[model samples]
Structures are given as C-alpha cells and as structure tokens.
Target: MTEETAPQDGPDGPDGPDGPDGRAARPDREGGAQAARPAGPAGDPGDAGARRGGRWRRPGPQQVPQPHPAAKGMWRGDAGGPFAQMTVMPGRMSVRLRLTLLYGLLFFMAGALLLFVMSVLMANILGNVKVIGFGISDAEAAELQRQFVEQTMRQLVGRSLLALGGVGVITLVLGWFVADRALSPLQRVTTTARRLSESTLHERIALEGPDDEIKELADTFDAMLERLGQAFDTQRRFVANASHELRTPLAINRTLLEVALGDPEASDDLRAVGRTLLATNARHERLIEGLLLLARSERELTARTPVDLAEVAATVLEHSARREHDNDVAVHPELTPGTALGDPVLLEHLVSNLVENAIKHNAEDGGELWIRTGMLEGYATVQVENTGPVVPAYEVERLFEPFRRLNADRVESAKGAGLGLSIVRSVVLAHRGAVYAVPRPGGGLIVTVRLPPGQPAA
Candidate 1:
C-alpha cells in the first residue's frame, strides 16, 4: 500500500486496527472497504491523532484570558464561567473603631431585650384589668377596656424605642471617646519607638499613670532601651580604642618602610621589596581608616552644620581629578545648590567615597562619569552615574556590605578596602537620610543619596 493510505501502526499492530470500542475493524457492504468509524466524543481533533497512533499536540501557544474591566480589585476564577468574579476583601478596621462598634452593638442589644421584657410585662398587667359597666353592657365595657390597653401599650413601646435609639447613639459617642483615651498611651509608645534611634535611644516612654498593662509594656520598653544604650556605648568605646591601637603599628610600619626605601645604598631587589612592603602597608592603613570611618558613621551625629553638597562634590572632583585622568574617564558635573545638615567632614567623605568608587569601577578604556547635585522633593540630593563593567542587579545590594566586591577577593583586589559604599550607607543613615544604588541600564551603577535640607548660610 502507498504511504498515504498505509495502515498505521496501532497498539495491536498494523494487521488489526481497533475501533473506538476496542473491537476489531469490520468490513463494509462493499466487502473490500472497512466500515466507517464513529468520530471521537466532543469531536476533538486530538482523538483522530490518537486513533492514528500519533501523539497529539497543540497547534499554537495557549492564550490566557484577561479579566473583565468591571472585575477590577476583585479576584477572578476560571475564564467565562459562573464563578469568574469573586468578592473583594474588605479593608482593615482599626482596633479602636472595632472596639467602639462592638460596645455600641452590645449596649443596643441589651436595651432591645429590656424593652421586649417590659412590653410583655405591661401587656399581661393590662390584660388582667377588670372593666366596670357604667352605661353599656358588660361585653361593650370589656371591648372598650381592651382597646384602651392596646393603645396605651402601643404608646409605651413607641416611646421606649425612640428613647433606646437616642441612648444607643449617645453610648456610641461615649465608647469612641473611651477607646481613644484608652489607646492614647499605646500611641505614645509607638511614636517614641519610631522616633528613637541609636543617637536618641536615651529617650524613654516614662508613661506615668495607674498601673495597667499598657504602663507595664511602656516600662518594659524603657528598660530595653536602657540596655541598648549601654551596649551602643560599649561599642563606641571599643571602636575608638581599636582605632587607636590599630593605627599606631600601621603608622610606624609605614614610616619604617619609607625610611628603608629612601636609602640610596639599597640594591635594586631590596628597593623593589621595600616598595612592595610600603604599598602593602599603605593598603593596611587605608583598611584601618575605612573601618574606623564606617563605625563612626554608623553612630548618631552629634553635630550638624549646613554643608553645601555642590561644594562638597566639587571639592571631591578636584581631588579625584588625577585618578579620573589616570583611568581615562571623562567627568561630567551638574552641580546645583544642595545644602544638607550634617558634619562637614563626614559629608565630604561621603562625596569623596562615591567619586572614588565611580572612577575605580569605571570601564578599563575611557568611560563616562556623570555627577548631579540639587534639591529634590524638598530634600538635598546627590546622584552619581557612571559607565563601567556590567554589574548584576542582584549584586548591587551586597556591594554595600563591608569587604564585599563583585567577582573579586577583598584582599587580592587593588580596589580600596571595599568599604566605600558601606561607609556611604552608614553616613546617610546616621543623617536620617536614604541611599540606594541600582545597576545602570547599559553598565555601571547609579547611586543616589538624599538628605534633609539645611538652611542656607546667611
């Protein structure tokens, strides 16, 4: 048989083609032709492929149905079905509001139950009254008495409902006030906790009132702050002591290395070794200084002066000019008046570190460096963007950590100490500002620093 009309291989082999019911094919009235098989259920084309012993496959990419515009803010289920739309979740209710509503509901329910009881009692009392016959028959007098009792009870229930409604409204207002008053101490605690930082940890809630749960909580918070302050104080001392102890040896070693390298009688090999030792000593010194600066910047700033960011950036640029030239990097500066409240020295260091990092991490060949400083959104801002090796977005955050570098060992890398970004973050945080870095679209990083605006010098 030709390939087009060939009997395809079946699970039962080509000799015996099975029908839909797994029975052997039967011959038609013509005797030579097979009987026509029924189409697969639901007329799915895949069933024909399955009957031919071929794997079924989708013709095109599956499409996902979009939710109806009216169903916005609501969850959707399967497409074009009865359960397509689901109810939107309700917004959160504050504890104070929830408490007030609960109180009013309970009071209103109790009032309703009391009113119901009173109506029952009144009905029974009125029903038992005996009617005296003055001018009518006993039956007529009884009917009049019944009408009188019904009217009196109607008036009683109507007045009572009105009074209960008014009382419920008043209770709701009272409950709201009570909830606010009760939660005031907690609000104080929250505010204090948010405002306190490493520098302001000495401030305490000191909530003074009748001893209650909230008061106890406030006292516990204050005690915790006390311990934190002590720990921070200890840390500050340790950093200071470590800085002093570490600097002396590094400084002495550098002086000795310089003295040895200066000797004219030294052989070329000895001089080369001395120069290498000097470089290593200088790297150690830089490391120590970076560590000390990082620690200091993590602490709270004790002094604040109005420092112009433009001036700081300009100064750092001037100092970094030689390095930029050496690296064959172009400088672009758009300095504007960006004044921030911070220590002048620390602010300068922050700017210097950013500039140095941009230059150091720039492309090996000539690259572009862009620096901008101005007031943005009521805050002084400094932004630095540069062209360099492509930095992964995921690795951007890790660069701020001490001794972290992308694809380079901290000790082996000539890049200074890997503490530049870490110190920048610490200084920004200490000034109650924010600093963040994102990978540039093409290459390098875009680092931005925002600080509180300071009043211009008069």
Candidate 2:
C-alpha cells in the first residue's frame, strides 16, 4: 500500500500559512490588521501613583542614616565646620555645665508642678466656702476674702521658689561629679591611644570593664594593632629572604659572565655580547642591592653608632674623585665635624648616593659639585649642590620617589636606577633625620639633610 504522509503541524503547515508556533498564521504583520493588546495600569513604574497602587516595591532593608558633615566635624572638634566654634554663650556649656543645667531644670520643673497643684487645691477650697455667718457687710467680706487669697498665694509661691532654688544648687553640684564619672572611660581611651605607636604596638588598651561599647572598641583597636605587628614582621622576613635568594643567583651570573669574557680564544662577537650581558647583570645587582637597602633603612634602628657626617662625605668624595675628574666635575668639599647617631654603613650609603647622583647628573663640562657638612641648629647637616639641568620647584618632591626621575625617558647610565634620592630619604627617616631639596635659580639642585646629633665618640 502507498503511504500518504500526514502534513506536519510546523511553521509551513498543511494550513498554508506559517507562524512562530508552526501553525496557520494571520496575514503578515505589515500588511494586515493586528490584534489589540489590553492596556496596563496607568502610571509609570516608579511614579507616585504606581507606588500608591502597590505596583512599585521598596528595598527590603531600611538604609542606615549617615552623620551630617557638620555633625561629624563638630564631634571631631575640627577647626572648621558648623557648631565647631559654637558655645552656649552668654555662658559656656561644658559637659559638666550642661549636666548641671539639666539637673537644675528638672528639679525646678518638679517643684513648679507641685506648687501648681497646691495652689489649685487652695483656690478650690476657698472658692466653695459661704460668707453669711460672719455678720459682716458683703463688700467688706469680699475685700477680706480677696486679701486672704492674695496673701496665701504670694507666700506659697515665694516659699516654693526659695525651696526650688536651694534644690537646684544641690543638684548642680551632684551633676558635676556624675558627668566626670561618665566621661572617665573616654579619658582612659584617649590616654591609651596617645601612648601607642609602631614601636609600642605590643601595648594594648586592655580596657578592663563590662562588655560595653567602649570596651568593645578598645578590644577591636588592640586586635588591629596585633594584626599590624604580624604583617610588619612578615614583610621584614620576606624582604630578608628575597635579598638572600635573589642576590645569590645574580652573583653567580656575574661570575659566569666574567669567566666567559676573560677567555683569550673567544671570538670578538662573543666577547662583546658577554661584556654587554655582564654590564646588564651588574645593573640588576645594583637595583637589587638598592631595594634591599631601602627596605632595611625604612625599619626602626636597632643599634646606632657614632658616625661623623663630615668623615662620611670626605670618604665618598675621595672614592668619587676619579669619576668626578673623568666627568669634568670639580669636587668642592666643605667638611666640619658633624656627628650623627645611625647605622654607619647606611649613613655612608646615604652620603655616597647623594654625591654620586650629583656627579652623574652634573653638567657635561666644568660641572661644580659642592658637598658641605656641619652642625646646624644641633643637627648634623650635609648639603650637596650640583650644576646640572634645571629642576622645577614642583618636581623636587617627586625626585624622592622610587624610580622617579625628571625626564620621563629613562637611560640607566644617566639616571642610575632612579633610587638614589629614595634610598637617601629612607636612610634619613631611619635615623630620625630630615632631607629636603630646593632647585637652584640657575640650573641645579641644593639637597640638604639634617641628622640628630649622636653621642660623643668614645
């Protein structure tokens, strides 16, 4: 038997028209009348009417209110912002004053309320009494009644006010004591915070009291400090490990490159490449050394030695004399005894880097390098100036940042890894010293460093 295939109910069905559901469709939308859809509710989604109709929803959580900017500054007692300079004057409303005023006001209000009740009762009792039994004229009886009521009220009010005044004085004295007690915990918190620093991180608030909000705050602060101490310790360990791990390989590479370059039978091309590689390797070593030194110098000094700033400057100049001569830079040293307490090696590095930087970036011909050291205002001071490209006053600050240089184009030989000033800053900070640089009027820089005076040399 011949099998007749039934028409599939698809877009092109036996019904002749195709639709999205594969059934007979209406005429093409552009050519035919379309069915109208029922209209939706009137207002836009977030409009007031929609909200009133319960069509718009609100967030499940109510947002917490933030303190006003003015209120924040007022609470912080900042130098500016609303209420920062406000006082309850005519009279100053200190915490104690405010508490005292509150106590007095409440006592006065209670006394006034009691007096009002007594006055009302007296008036009611007098008002209800009849005057016929006294045998006096109506006018006279009325006059007598009036005088009696007036005298009674005057005495009542006067005595009640006097008692209120006396109570108010007593309440004020008590309020002062109460206010002081209430603020004692806050005072403790302030004292603890003032005494805490990086060096004293082991100390804690240890607020011994009930589990109140202030106690909780103190505990949180202590926990934060503990975490900070741990983080700092970890960082120191990481820097030490990295210095050891990275320096060993760099030293080995330098040794290998040097041995290879030393071969007499090596080809010229090979020798040239070896020399370049060795130079690059040496630059990497200097960079690593600079980073390690910078990290070490940022930490608190554990041991200090008496180091003479003038001697350090003189030694650095002596070492750099050959470079200065080759670069056509004249070294002018004005050294005086300026002793500082710090790590001797780090101080030496600080001096050498400053001097080297001055030489490196000096004028191409007849550059003048001046290094001066002496005591300035009880500080061991070292000042270095060089004749080089002009430096802008604004860019002086950025020079102390790691890998930051005046010219964006970085030539390693010219800039020397851009860490000289940064390392100097770190060392200065480690020794509790200050370093600042100012651009000279012509074309150069005058960098000054002042270190705290050290103990007398033994």
Candidate 3:
C-alpha cells in the first residue's frame, strides 16, 4: 500500500469518530475540508473508519467550486453596487437599466465631442494671434502670446470638464425618472397579473394613457383575459348541464335493473344477468360521479370553512378500514391537528379518494399503507404512502391525469376508472394547495398534499 493510503493514528492524526470541532463527522465524496482519514478501495474496512474520522481523501478529478446562488443571476454589464443596478436574465436585459446607461453615455460622449471641437477652434485662433504692444520687442511679444495661449487652453479644458460632469449627472437622474414613467404601464400589467386568478379573471388592466406601445400591450392583455373568461364560463356551463343530463339516465337504468332483480317470476339465469347489469350500472354511476366531482373541484371555491385535515383523514380511515381489511391491506394512520380553510366535504373526498386508491391498487397480500396528517412548514399536510408493484418515476405524473393508469391490465383488475388521482389534484388546486407523488425505491408511491393553514377561530 502507498504511504498516503496507509492509516495513521496520533494526537495530530484524523479525529476518531469526531471532527476538530467536536461534532460527529462523516467523509464526503467531494473531499471537503474536514478532518477525515482518506478513503480507499471498496470492501476495505479501514476506509469505513477513515470516513467517520472526517479525513477521507477522494481519488480522481477534483470537484468544481459552485458559485453562490445569489451570484448566479448576475450578467456581464450589471452595475457594481446599489446606485446603478440591473439584473440580466438569459436572453434578456433590463430595459430600464439599458436606457439609463445609454442616456448617460450618449450625453457624456456628445459633451466631450463638443469640447474637442471648441478646443481645436480656440487653439487655431490663439496660434495665429500675437501680443502686439507699443515699445515691445519681438521676443517679448512672442513670450506674452505663449502665456496667453497656455492660460486660455487650461481654462477651457477645466471648465468644459466641469460642465460635462454636471450635465452627465443630470442626464442620469432624468433618465431614471423617464424610464420609470415609460414603463409604468408594464408595472400595472404585472400587478394585475399577480392578483389575477380564476376568481379574479374579470379584472382588466384598463390603462388610461396615450395610444402608444404600452397602451396597446395593455389592451391586448385585456382582450386575452376576456376570451379566457368566456371560455371558462362556457366550459363550466357545459359540465353542469352534461352532469345533470347524464345522472338522470344512470339513475333510471339502476332503478330498472333493481326492479327486474326483485321480480319473483324472473328465472335464475335472468336474475343473474339482472344482478350483473345492476353492478355495471353502479360502476357507471360511480364514474359519472367522479367526473362531476372532478369538474366542480377544478373551479375556485366561493365558500370556505375551517376544517381539520387530521379529522378528515381519520374519518376516511374509519370508513375504509373494513374494505382494506377485506383486501388484506394493512392500514396505519398518524393523525395530528392539521387545520386549513377549505370546503370540508371536498377535503373529506380528497382524503377518502387517497385512502381508497392506496388500498385498491396495493399489493394483493401483506400490503402496507401509511396515512399521516400534520403541520409541515406552516402548512396543513396530508401524506399517504403505500407498498405495491414498482411504479416508475416517469409514470408518477401520468397517474394524475384523468382516465390514466399505470398499466392497461390494472384498469380491469383494479376496477379503478382512473379518476381518483385526477379528482385529488383538482381538489388540491381548487383549494390553492400543492400535491406531489414520488415512487419509493423498492415499490409503491408516497403522495403528499400541503394546504395553507387556517385562521384561528374568533
């Protein structure tokens, strides 16, 4: 073994299981500055102890120093300090900054050019003149002329520079005010955009100014919002009408099937067929109900009440325990107070759908499910994790889309119309919450939803 690879121990040696700062240390692969024993080849037991010593050395290419995150957005022409500042994002430059710099530079250049021209004219005029005084020798006259020319040139240069400095300062100050005024409409546009949402789609920029580029932009933005509002209204109306029309027929069909199955004169085979029809009809009803709920949940909620997410999860678990038990899926819940402001019924539906999907698509035997609710990062959080077949990372996002399943085979066996996650996403969005799912390393998925906390009751 090389001397560098050989492990040594002494007072000056790498700290054993602790760092120089007296904290437990672990060897980092990047070889950061910590008192660690150098790491060696795999299956080497000494390397493990070296790692805990915080003195491990990595072999191979050195790691590059990462730039500070605050410095990442800086650009080539960005100003050095607070007085003159601009941010440069990729493919774009700050318009306000560009205008200010160009204004100041152009003014200074013009002033400098004017001074040069005036200086050249003055020099020419001085060069041709002589100091002609009575009883003066040619030498004396030449000396006096030289003095006049030197003094004139010096004064001209000094005064021109002072004037240029004053004018340049004025140009920069004016440029800032002018740029801000010219971009006032843009600020208004941004403010409106920040405040806009499904409920605030009716608000318009309505900029009152000259019919210039900024005004035109504001008008165009307003037109786009108008079109979007109309489209949303049309879609919402169609969904409402379709849901009512679809549900009536499904109800009638279910009633007819139940009546047929109840008939005493019905033959055994006929009764079996009637029972099958009833089951299929019930599935159709559920599919329709899911679609309707999904549509409603996509819209902004007009009314919100304080709700305990933990209680919602508890209620769902209670109702779903028997079903999970029948399917041999174990249910484990850690419910804590996670309160938020939302429609309680919709919150209940979100929890129920998550639990049902976890149980339904879980392992056929010895399945494990975890449901938890608590406060996380100042938000009410609900999380559900389950063990099932290996779910690919790429397919996790597709599960949230309507009528989408991991596999076509699962559509039949799981009896999932594939709208459970879709509804969950819609509800979460309607409540202004965030939902995420990640596949476990071994198998299954971990789903988490975070909603804003509710205000304390008066």
The backbone clash count of each candidate, in order, is 0, 2, 8
Model 3, which residues run further than 4 Å from truth?
A: 1-94, 133-147, 303-305, 322-327, 409-413
Stretches > 4 Å off in candidate 2: 1-200, 303-306, 322-327, 409-411
State TM-scores per candidate. 0.73, 0.62, 0.73
True-structure RMSD for candidate 1: 22.2
Worst 10 residues of 2 by lDDT: 23-32
Residues 363-431, candidate 2, lDDT per residue (tens digit)?
887889877665543445677878899887677777888898886536375467888988987787666
Query: lDDT value for candidate 2?
Result: 0.64
Candidate 2 or 3, higher TM-score?
Answer: 3
Regions more than 4 Å wrong, model 1: 1-98, 130-146, 322-327
Computed on alpha carbons, the lDDT of every model, listed in order, comes to 0.69, 0.64, 0.67
Higher-scoring candidate on lDDT, 1 or 2: 1
Give the 10-residue window scoring lowest on summed lDDT in candidate 1: 20-29
State the lDDT of candidate 3 residue by residue for 69-139, as single tens digits. 21121211112311122222346767887888888999999999999999999999999997889999999
The candidate, 1 or 3, that scores higher on lDDT is: 1
Q: Candidate 1, residues 166-281: lDDT per residue as tens digits?
A: 99999999999999999999989977875676778889999999998999999999999999999999998999799889999989998988898889899999989998998888
